[model samples]
Target: MSTFFFSSSKAPSSVSSFPSFSTHSSSSPIHTFSESMMEGRIENAKPIITKWNLNSSSYTKAISVFGHNRKEAKELLKSVKDLFQAMHFLVSENSPSHKLVLAQTLMQIAMERLEHEFYQILSKHCDQLNPKSVSGQSSDESRNSDNKEASEDEDELKRAGKTITEEENVSQLAMSDLKAIAECMISSGYGKECIKIYKLIRKSIVDEGLHQLRIEQFKASRIQKMNWEVLEYMIKNWLSAVKIAVKTLFSGEKVLCDHVLSASDTIRESCFSHITEEGAMNLFRFPEFIAKGKKSQEKIFRQMELYEALTDLWPEIELIFNYDSTSAIKLQALSSQQKLGDSIQTILYEFESRIRKDLSKTPTIGGGIHPLTESAMCFICSLGDHSEILSEIFAEHPPRNSTITETNIGSSTSNHSSASPASVHLAWLIFVLLCKLDRKAEPCRKDLSLSYLFLANNLNFIIEKVRTSHLKDLFGEEWMSMHNKKLKQYALNYETVAWTKVFSSLPEKSSSPIPPDAAKECFRRFHAAFEEAYMKQTSWNVPDGKLRDELKISIAKKLVPAYREFFDTYIMMVNGDRNLEVLVRFGPAGLENYLSDLFLGTHILLSSSSSLSCSSSLGCIIR
Candidate 1:
């Protein structure tokens, strides 16, 4: 016999069919009539069930009543509600066992109709229910956008009502349709069917979204074997991908799942966890996978980049995957962060070891900035830029034995009391660099003054680096001031060794008269010592401009006035003597001009003449 599932309008007065039934006698002819009437009631539920069935011959396509026909959608929803009431009455009556079978079949048909409708709405409304839209619309808001009758019916079923949209946002309407069908099927005890379809479809959306973002399911082994450029590219893609995935993709899925399956927390959590967990774990596990590869200075920056990404997105991750079933996603994210931190720590240790173990004997020509000084400071300054992130990492893995401060200055100059653990570690690394540089200077000691120049150059380079980069803030004012003083001391030591012979050639005080014979002797010694020091210093360089100028000015202040005094006091004594030019040499203005040519990082020749004279403002020129 044909059956007819009654829509809301055609539903018979048999709406009272869900009432508990009793007969005057336990076994009577009236009870037999009840069975026949119940059997008719069961048959009537089949036409709408069969014709509107998702797989029926007449409607094989996925045309959702919810999406295209609000009238049919409302009728289908009413049919399912009535079917559940019939199923309840059959269970309570315990008679009409065959009609109970028929009722079960019709209920299955109604469930199938609603299930198809649920799937159709979700599939066709992908644009409307996209991650961006779903995230902003709450379940209550979606329900509020439902048709007035549908909204009232859902309030009875779920009471999911809220004021979120002033206008008819299409996403809200789409979500509302999905929610209505979901509640209908779930209340009919076909939640598993509804959830199964949901997980399959939504999981694919998540997977496809990830693929579009260029995120791969990177295994540790696969990522390790990949070329670094390829790995680095993927990391950049992931860095961009993770924010969208966490904040939008998975987050929106969670919001939608929580709303559509609001009738059952257990079902929704299971549905959401199954749909997105695997993809999310894979997303977060990417850093851990990369971290499993070799640790080197080249890879450390990427690892820290990954660490920063995870740390930055952790709050959202926790809140989205905030279910017991979804805890593994959080665990995976945390695991990746820890592994990246470890990789960073290993690379730093390797960096430190390289500095400590650098025993290369090559000294930089011109006593300029050394290769080690440039490389080590460049690396340390880069680390300083990320010190805020590293501060937390260093808290977990602090430097070992950073307090060994038996430096040439006799104590640790860096004051790390107010510094972060990151700053402390960087300061310790710089200390190690200073010690290495100290050892490096030994090879230059053949020229004791050159050795001091080497120290001055390197220390000056270090101080300038600290001044210009993020390291300045991290190292603090005290660290910079202390290092500045050390650099000045090195310069002072260089000046003392280099200029002593020249200064010694002249009398301690330039004063009164002198005989031409003694004046000639004094001038001869002064010319030889002055030319020697100036020629030597010209070959060396102070790369920093400020330091170089200061050194030049300091030397000028000392030598110019004293020698001018010597020249003025003794000139007349020698002027009248025979071969007087032998006792007279450079004029005071010429001496000052010659000093300007010093520290040019190139040497100018000076003639070893019997006498030389001040030629011009540019200094004495050898002929």
Candidate 2:
């Protein structure tokens, strides 16, 4: 007695034909009739048996058919449904054949049905899902609205019994069926399809504007379920994709460096150009702004925030591009290096140039400082932590001679010999600004004293800035001290070198009175020196009143006593021999008055004969 499971070309047969249920002895008529009736029912259902076999190839063919031939898939689905119902009634629940066929057929039907439903939904919503379909409207809004419409259409289809609702479709899938489908797809090397399916589902949910909400729900569910392995796998894949994209984007160091430099230029121009007097005041005077009002201050603060954002962005880019590598290593592994130093230098140079240009347009006041000075100082201070890196880049550039060096004015050796590269670079930037200011003052050269005064004021401003801010630390305490000393020395140099010549006309303090010819010659020389010094030094300026006063007093110390003694002695000789009034050109009072006119940036010299007359009288005093 054998049971038969129908194959594609075979008719269904009974579970086990009653082996000639013996009508002899104990065979009950009721059982015999029941067995015969069951066989008859099985045979009747045989003609409607499905033509498809229960195998992987058949399952694959059915799925393909469902995707392209919906009508045929529907007929097949109905047949499979009928077949499942018949088998439940006719075959024993414990039969191995029944169990195998039931499991395989159920999974195949479920997968095919899911694919079919997905395609149907896609077709109906094609216009909404297609990005090209909606040209003018906001895509997200359009897609969301379309998704709602699609869901409503799906519900309508369900009500009409033409399609399954999403909930119903999902309910048809058992855990075992899903596992079987996954295993089959993976074993067949169609694992990527699984990912595609997941992405499609995500896209659909996102288009419906429910992605974020769903993700939150999923996360909450996952915490309770705790499927760590699946979560970890997903995270690993995501991270790997991100890493690949980063590597690709940063593949060329030169390109990356160029992009960074370009970005830096843009940021510098935008931020620096907005630095007006009011903006700068807001930046440096935060407490003042708070006390006053902060509305106008917001824009300035936002621009400042750009610098902070760039600062944060820079380090990450540096790390990824391996910018910390040594120069030798970069040369050897040139393919891997980013040439970060070149980019850094480009940025710094642009910033320096900007500062120079801005400061040129800035107005010079005796006591008040230009806003750029404070802004620039703040910018430099921001870079204080980057000093080591900046210093290295600065060291690579050769130092150029500046105005201080060009004029043969002496600066302290400590300023150059002991200063750090960063400090020197900062000093160079300031000097360039001063040089620009001097160029603007060139027209004032006719009054050379005013030009000099322009230089003095700007230089003094720089010295004070360095001494007061973090620039002092960068440029060093010695550097600041040296700058201050250099300024004083410059003042003294102007006085002694330019003014002393005027006093040189005095005759040597002689034990014997000079001859009349010698005294007359001394007076002539004195007149020339006094006129030259007065004309030259008066045009040159010392803008600071205190400084101007100090310079005048210094000139007086050198010339007053000498002129007085020469006058007293010469007056006696001239009084005895010649007219003392004719020889004595100027007395201590007149000389002191002349010295007082120095550094006022004025042209206070008397006419040549007037100057000579003034000198000739003093000429007798020496005699």
Candidate 3:
């Protein structure tokens, strides 16, 4: 009784015949009912889909359903694949869909699965069917049996009634669906799967000739919808992946390294795609990752490793060098200094290297971004600020003259002061003063002469004779071109101004218990240079207009009074901490009187800077 009821329930309707069902008899009841009935159902639906032109729309709906629920999507997608396979059977039977619905179905399923094997299979089959490949095969197989087999295979290939190009169009649509699904997987927290899918997408990119497809997708739509949660995950993990890949490269995991490197290159290209030159340089300048809990030494070591890797990235290094030489110096400084005195040693080495070797193989331009001239200048500025401490550091690590050979030539020369730390310090100061004046092109009628002379006497050469054109030539042009510039072209126009600022900023009083001998030398030379340069550079210049002359006279007349004011200020500032030993060592007998004159000179320069553009007034102020 139960069997009869089951048979009745399974029976097809016999009411006005819309379609007829074929029953397959199998030894296994389950296979007959389940596989055959389902397979037959797909076979029957294919023609209906073709007749009704619903293949495209139905497949789209299936995709949407699959996205909402993977299990349901998989089931629906599997059914679609089966349906297409059934259509292949119909094509073999010499009956095919008008739109080749089975072929379209297969294309959709292949796209949905995004299986590499499936792509490989389709590609292989497509290659065989290509006009070029088939042409020769067709000519060789002319027998009736061969003809029938060819006809059947051709029919299966054409089940969609579309040409190879049309089939490819359908396949491309499927490929797009695969991309969408991969993105969905990533969004749904299936990152490993997403990465796998991405790999497949990349392969498809090559196979399908779609360049930057993933990047375009990321830019076009996906990134905008991303919340902080998604963003944080990507940011924190993306570089870890890159680091992991880089680590593999060192560990001999060649294949893994290759894949990671490829991925990293892609990611870097995408990231920098929208960055400006400044922004990119700034990005590299900032330390991206530092090892946690490392002390200074270890931190320095780790940073050196990263710096080496970065420098090896020639393109990035070049960009950094072009964009910010200061940043490059800082990085290079850090790189060279993992060990003791490494930065200074490297600099000395570079200077020696340049002297010893012809630099034909080197880059045409260097130091433009980070010249030794600037670095040396920075040392002077540091001393100018905290001379009491910088003086100590200077003494310990005296500025080195790396020309071991040059020293022997001048060995007997009592100008050993030039090799002294004080001398080197003064040289750097002079260089910096000249550079500042040249760069700013500002007038300096101030108390700069004293400081300039202090540097000049100890530094072995006054401005013109310093072999390196780093400072002298730089300022010389400005001195000559001053007439062409905004200020009156005093021979020492900018040079004077730069020196004034330098002198004003230099340490007048010692922070330590007592001042070093260097400080006294600095003070004495400062005064002499001040008086001479001012009297010489300004006094003999061309005549000024009457108004400028009156201004200069007013300046000169007030110089005595201004000197009084400056002397009083200086006495007060130094009196609080003056060391009698240092004062006496640095002295003209009457410091009070000397201070007054210095201030008077400074006042004249400061005032005349506004009027007498020539050196005549300046010469008097200094004198």
C-alpha TM-scores of all predictions: 0.84, 0.38, 0.23
Better by TM-score, candidate 3 or 2: 2
Model 1, 1-623: lDDT tens digits are: 00132233232223233334443464643444454555565666666666675445545433556656666677767666765665565565666577676776667666656766666667777756843344355655543443347655445334223443422245666766777778877776677667877887888888999899888777777877889999899988899999999988888888888777777778988999999988898898899988889877778777888898899999999999999999999999999988888888888988999999998875687788889999999999988888888988878766564564424222233343565777767878888899899899889898878888888889889888989998877767767777888888988888898888888887766356666687778888898898888888888887888888998899999888888878777765555666555445567877877888877789987533635444446343222
In order, what is each prediction's RMSD in angstroms? 6.9, 21.4, 24.3
Candidate order by decreasing TM-score: 1, 2, 3
Name the 10 consecutive residues with the lowest summed lDDT in model 3: 361-370
Error in Å for residue 560 of model 1? 1.2
Error (Å) of candidate 1 at residue 309 is 0.7
How many clashes in each structure? Answer: 2, 15, 15
Error of 3 at 534 (Å): 12
Give candidate 2 regions above 4 Å deviation. Answer: 1-341, 347-421, 424-465, 481-493, 510-524, 543-550, 568-586, 607-623
Candidate 2, residues 1-623, lDDT tens digits: the string is: 01122133322222231111223333533333333344444344333223323333556434444335534434444444344343433343233443434433443433333333333333343223322212233322322222122244336445634454444333222211222233333232233333234234323433333222221222223333444455434334433332332233222222212221122333222222221112212222221221122122112222223223323334433443343222222232221112233334445566666756653543443212345555665566555545555565556543343433412222432236755666666666665655565565565556444445555555666676566676667765555666677667656655555656667788877678887677666766775687677776776555557667877887789888987776665554444444434445566777777788776656785532322232554443221
Q: Which ten residues in a row have the lowest lDDT in candidate 1?
A: 1-10
Model 3 regions more than 4 Å off: 1-41, 44-73, 87-596, 599-623
Two-way lDDT contest, 1 vs 2, winner: 1
